[model samples]
Target: MVQSDSKLHEVALQKLNDRGVELKEIAELVYDLQSPYLAELTMQPCLESVKAVIRKREVQNAILTGIELDVLTEEGKLSSPLQEIIEEDESLYGIDEILALSIVNVYGSIGFTNYGFLDKTKPKLIKRLDDHTHSNKTHTFLDDIVGAIAAAAASRLAHDNPGISKIMK
Candidate 1:
């Protein structure tokens, strides 16, 4: 990574930390999601995989954009009608997932499958973010975005380890 890329990643990581999202939380989610498929899995690889995925400019942009939207919704800064839609996290508001898919799409088709599973299962921080949406707090897009990051990282992990033959679909 270049100096500017490193700076961007640092800024993005700071933004995530500001929003109460931890790299370790994301790394743990990756491990939990991919552990079953690997005969020998460790948190170090999972953590590194998450770092690799987030290092991408595309993923950084997604994280910043999604988290900003959630912050806007939480602060009631968004304009009416749309604000209501996002604050409520309506079923029709799918842009969050759309932005998140940009991150998943980086890895390949397998990332899509992993994303689908994590989104459906809402494991770890995903479940926390989803539950937070019900309160005065808002995580309209963060949950889905984080899930995509984890899913993408898991896919990267599978791709890196040559011994793993059958990844669960």
Candidate 2:
């Protein structure tokens, strides 16, 4: 990665941290998605996949944009119904999911299905991020970003290790 890319990566990571997201949380989601498919798996590769996904410029932009919007909403800086829509995470407010798909689209078609599953299940960390009742924080975008990262990482992991599928065939 170039210096500018490195800077973007660093800032994206920082934004995730600022939003209370840990890499382990994302990695755990990857494990949950891939472990059932892999005969034997470890968190190390899952973590590596997440790091790889985060390094992508596309993902960095999504992270920055989504988190900025969520922060703006939380601070009540966004305007009118737009703010209310994002804050409430209204079912019709599919923009968040649309932005998240940009991150998942990087990997492959598998990511689409993985993202759907994670989004529907709302696994532990995602569940926490999605909780609007406990605090004034807004994760309307962060939660989807987190799920997208995991879905992308899981897709990468599946692509990297195809031994199981090869054996099955």
Choose the strongest candidate by TM-score: 2
Candidate 1 vs. true structure, TM-score: 0.91
RMSD of each: 3.0, 2.1
Off by over 4 Å in 2: 1-3, 165-169
Q: Model 1 over residues 79-144: C-alpha lDDT tens digits? A: 999899888888788998899999999988889998998888898888988885346778888889
Q: Which residue window of length 10 is worst by lDDT in model 2?
A: 160-169
Per-model TM values vs. the true structure: 0.91, 0.95
